[model samples]
Target: MTPHNELRLLPWSGPDGKPCFLSTDDTGGPLSRLADTTETAQLNVGQEILGHAMDVLADEEVETEELRLLARDLATALRDTLRVAVSRGHRLPALDPSTPIEANEGLRLSAAAFG
Candidate 1:
């Protein structure tokens, strides 16, 4: 893995049993829990699209102008996600909609909810 600015180089076995490369971010949160079990970090949205771009650029696949546009779109998605996280709040429980929704039964609930 080679870290380049916000992108990190990732290597993996291709379908043909050869090594392939992808660009990723080491700092981003996991895209899924499954990836945590591998040497690869869970890919964020930007990294997922960028990986496709890497495949195309590697010349083992078709080349198209659309890939450049896709990379840009992924970059924007990552930037927006981070911006929203920063602007709205940082606590994890608040961000997750599945977290228990408790009523203001008493001061304890309020304290736990805010914390």
Candidate 2:
């Protein structure tokens, strides 16, 4: 079985001394077997949301509070999208209803904010 909690967070300094958060995980099976699958797609979507948040932060004119709140909102959106996708996928008996389909760390990070 593949390892869990493979989520890797990468923070970089953005404009105006703001920190940008990014993460990538491949817990959804191997790429040789089509990493573009739905689970993987969901992960990619989450990354996209993060990237967009970074772009929003690059504007440099927005308030820090607003940026933090936007980052949190994006994180939640990513989590919700991933959760719904996973819930709709195959229902394994051995797997717990709460067992996250992607990396466990990714699940935890689903609520991460820029602050």
How does each model score on lDDT? 0.43, 0.49
* Clashes (candidate 2): 0
Per-residue lDDT, model 2, residue 96, is 50
Q: Give the alpha carbon lDDT tens digit for every residue of 16-81 in model 2.
A: 855333223343445312423534555666778778788887898988888888878787766646
Which candidate number maximizes lDDT? Answer: 2
TM-score of 1: 0.28
lDDT of 1 by residue, 1-115 (tens): 4433332212234589653333344434453122232322323554676676676677755546666676677776665444433322322223344544463222233342221
The lDDT of model 1 is 0.43
Model 1 steric clash pairs? none
